[model samples]
Target: MPTVHLLDYVAGNIRSLVNAINQVGYDVEWVKTPEDVKNAGKLILPGVGHFGHCLSQLDKGGFLEPIRQHIEAGKPFMGICVGLQALFQGSEEDNNVPGLGVIPMRIQKFNDTSKSVPHIGWNSAINTGSDDTKNESFYGLRPTSKYYYVHSYAAPYNPGVLESDGWSVATATYGEEEFIGAISRGNIFGAQFHPEKSGVAGLRAIHAFLNGDQFQSLSQDLVTGKENGLTRRVIACLDVRTNDSGDLVVTKGDQYDVREKSGADAGGSVRNLGKPVDMAKKYYEQGADEVTFLNITSFRNCPIADTPMLEILRRTSETVFVPLTIGGGIKDTVDTDGTRVPALDVATMYFKSGADKVSVGSDSVFAAEDYYRAGEKLSGQTAIETISKAYGKQAVVVSVDPKRVYVDKPEDTPHHTIKTQFPNSNGQSFCWYQCTVKGGRETRDIDVRQLVQAVEAMGAGEILLNCIDKDGSNAGFDLELIRDVKASIKIPVIASSGAGVPAHFAEVFNKTTTDAALGAGMFHRGEYTVSQVKDHLQTEGFLVRQFET
Candidate 1:
């Protein structure tokens, strides 16, 4: 098998990239030291986290010169996400740090006032640098295909800027902001998207680059979308826990209760839905944009290193090409042997095991409370901050468990209250989303708005806004709750729980500005597949990414 050298300079879900590489008939050789870089014929640099940190680490490890030499020598090179950002002159994210200056451009942050900060979802990477009338594909990037992107900073796509300099560019639009999605010139190539998590389309690009298929004449039938932006993401979530018989199973809860109330077992056993890894693969095959796993039981009795959840993530990521988010028990803890482990270490373990993002649940609630107590000041010691700083804000997701607290008026409590369309039994029309902890068993004094704002300030990239009032209800998403949460912060918000059918997803997308919608019970019950939901979205005239084989 052919070998591709990967610079293992930082911590990330590099395993997925390796899996993608192996799937395309190429073997990965780790460039651990500067000496290893010399032996690399086809080098791939994957960057995640802060701009300064990625460059500084590369500089500190003595890899900058070797990488520079590799590029100067005209060796085949590819960069993913921040790895793409590393080739530019510098970035607004870290002005003090200098980039490799291969592209002769500086990266800038997206206009967050117009859209979400990280731009987390799938977007087009069409080769817009073609000089002729023909639609040409570069590095297997098609105008009709979409790739997964998650970042706040990118090289802004200015017409003819890179092309005049003998460079190829593929651009993606985010709320009127056209940015460089993929760029290539000579033997140097870079992608601001995560090709490994981009399904078969991404695999094809990886294959093309590895096989030296730089410019492919795309079929004339293939055309770019007339209206292109980020696609509405549909995620399949699996709530995993050990059942009563000590078997790990994917279970869905009604308002956080996993036991059946009127079945033959009649609340005597845990509702075992399916195996975690199997269900995840099924959803992936059904064209789910992403798969998420929440270990409900927290793996309390086992050591962190030996937990089965890591195995689940490893197995799921091997086949599921989209992003994989792992939640539950991501907080600081003590090992069985009495060694203290921080939450960042816990999250790193999952990242190493192939999780693209780590979801912080109760830990985030605690961090938010501490923030309010400290007069809304940030403590750099929090798990979200540490992980975000190390792996970029896009890798850290704050899973919010919130329930509605009805009130007669806005003055009912000292929290952000919204007038609701659905009144309570007491005829209360105003309510506040009270943040919860311990899987919705404990309620905190803080509200959803406060928690989201605090965490976003602390560097959280996305919010998994799960409504305790809607979990397993199968009615629909709490639109009021989703709208209120969306109004509070600028990061991507994933609406989870209370999805009964495909229309539920459509309704959420149509009524609110949710970045993504997640289905747990509806998908697990075998009532509807992820493809069905996507089909429904397409039928409604919304832009939906088709699942590629």
Candidate 2:
């Protein structure tokens, strides 16, 4: 086995890539400087950031020429995400920044039009070439091989030209466009999707790339959406808070204020419905595609010191096979000992405790405000950048808890206002989604649209769209909020808050561009199970992950 040289650009998920490679019995050596690239064996360039930013870093570190030389020498080389985009001529993301020009094609943003842009989540990659020799990167993958994707820009697929240019393309249709998913050109290969984050199929893809002949064809029955032809996720969200008795319980809140805090519970003032771990396990048993635990009160305390929260994750992961997301207080904090801890370190603790993703709410807004003050600047030290660099952008989620601020006219303020589906009491028709911090206690200058774009550039994988006004109201999801946020950003969005019934879930799925619909109040009140929601989604002619359980 040769040493797999993994390139680090100070922006990519070096940690997750290393873990994936090591899982398949391959030893990885991190390549930082140009000298490391020159001395590389079996090089792999994995990165995710602004297209221009990645290229600038590579050039500044003197890695461009050395990496090109290594690949030109016929060494096995691979690129992932931004790395793959870097191989093309340039990108629409930043037109001035030039790529390595290894391929003549220019990377373009998904031409989704009015649909979802980023095209996140699992999707099948149908191989264009029948011969394995032509499609070596997708060596053992079947026609419907599902790989996890998280990218807004992709290489344009010209089946004729790609095949003639010594590249075999596997394409996926996102909205109105069919873009390249994976490309293999001899020893030079690239994957627009993150193979490491693609789960079992992903692991196999990495293994086959490193250790030849290790790839095993999976059964069709094991595929996520083999029957439906497309994959959509159903998420179960648990709003966690401490009751009056100091016991951590899953609670439901209305309009960003939980029942426990107001002592307006139907059963008790505390609103202690059940334990976190127990409820999580119950949801997992009910065939939930994913689970999210939002520690509503963690904003007031140090999340790292929240032992019960970490304990819930550890215990739940042992039983829950799906992904687990934790939100609230995922920012930098000072410990009781007066030691300041970086937000990255805080996210690391959550990941170590079995959290697949961490949602940054208040911290993200602060980071964006800092960027706004610093001339559209971005620091690598921020929680979003650091966490994404370590765990991949797919692991970092930005929870946007925004409220509708109705006004007389759209142009009254400099914010992007939407015509409200539900008008205000004064009959004000236009409104702007005001971004909030500290669980909606304080509103920020930036709106939801600006925050979404800023955080995406800062390396947030997905956005957990939370509507403060509609939260726990059981009126249904804030469809207006969902549409506005979903249309603004290209990343995957999980529509949250104000889910009342099974029809609400279906409505969001059918009407909005959200990749997933999350429910807390409905699930907590025993109104609908995870399986029940999935069943309803399936019955409505929507694609959802089917479970025998």
Candidate 3:
């Protein structure tokens, strides 16, 4: 049996890919050195990260030449996501850097201004050419097979590269342009979308790639394959922090402030309500479509050092089958012993600990600032871009904590300000949301709209729109804030904070185009269950998953 060698670089989704390949009964070996690449029977280069960084790492590790030689030898090889981009001569992501030139094309960032940049969701790939039944990638894939994609740049399909006798390609149209979704020239295969995360349709492609069979048969009943027809998701959030007793517990704070009064007790207010794993399992059992654990103090401490957070994830993942998102304190860290860790490495650890997506809060503010100052995303490596690349953008979410700054006139500030339905203390008529970092402790000059645009361009798969003013107030979601931010960006937006009742859940979904609604205190305190929220939405004529009794 031929073994599949997965190129384990700093920017690849090694764990997810390993799980996917292993599910198909293939033994995967990690390849780092050129010798490993040369000796491997079949090679797979998988990555999600910046164009220059990925290419630079490959060059520095001496795997570049071996990769080119492997493709030249006509042995079976596959390039996934960034790996597919690396096969091209260059990318617009970093114009100065060049790829391996295996495909003789230049990668271009999606340039259509009308559509969202990082096309982050389930989209379909269709056959672009004459019916070629022999194409390996599309062998068992049905027409218009929906696959999960998280990319800002892609290889522009050019017939010149299809000169090889067996060369064929499939296209996925995004915005106004059509780009190559899958490519195969002789024994080499590449896909811009992630098959590992695409469910059954994607796994079929992986199985076919391994067996060297052009066609794989599926049962007639299973023909209607797995599609990410994800409806509006209901997510349960647990704001976790260390209580006065130094125990990790879920706590809810009012307007981003969790304080215990001097009159309450010694030390501080005991906001410790419940344990993390316990709450997570409870929410999962209650039919939460997803669960999020925010290490409320993670910004002050290195996540790598937070063994408790990792344990929470490991324990919860075993019991919960739904998607899991983790946020708080996900920045680059330097240890006291002089050891430095990249932000992407931190994300890898989170994923390995069973986090399906890692959310960045303060780091996103900084990345947006740098990107705006440089006028291009090539300014510096950011956690959002790097992590999104390694895990695919869908696995990365940006949590924005924006406090509404009411202003009398929008023109007074350079940032985009919205007229308020409710007036401020001075009876101010207009307001602009100021993006904050450090758990909303420090405010920045950046506007929430500007930050959203910048992070989306930088490759954030989704936005966790949080309002510091409405947080834990239970008044309701800041509809103006959610609507304004949703109008500015095309990526899926999850309206966070200020959801008090079942009606509030329907209000956000009914009024705005938010892809999901998240609740914390309401669900955590037993006031309402995830099922209750879904029941209300369902009664309101909204599509919701009916929990199995």
- Scored by TM-score, the top model is 1
- The whole-model lDDT of each prediction reads 0.91, 0.77, 0.78
Query: 61-163, model 2: which lDDT tens digit per residue?
Result: 8999998899899887888888888889899988998999999879987766565656676666666653433323354454445666777788877768978
Residue by residue across 369-481, what tens digits does model 3's lDDT show? Answer: 99888876554489987787666677889999999888779889998999988998799989999999988999999999999999888878889999999999888899999
What CA root-mean-square deviation does each model show from the true structure? 1.4, 5.8, 6.2
- Candidate 1 residue spans exceeding 4 A from truth: 129-133, 224-227
Each model's TM-score, in the order given? Answer: 0.98, 0.73, 0.71
| Model 1 lDDT tens row, 81-162 | 9899999999999999999999888999999896888889999988885433687778998888889999889889899988
lDDT for predicted candidate 1 compared with the true structure: 0.91
Ranking by lDDT: 1, 3, 2
TM-score for candidate 3: 0.71
Q: How does candidate 3 score on lDDT?
A: 0.78
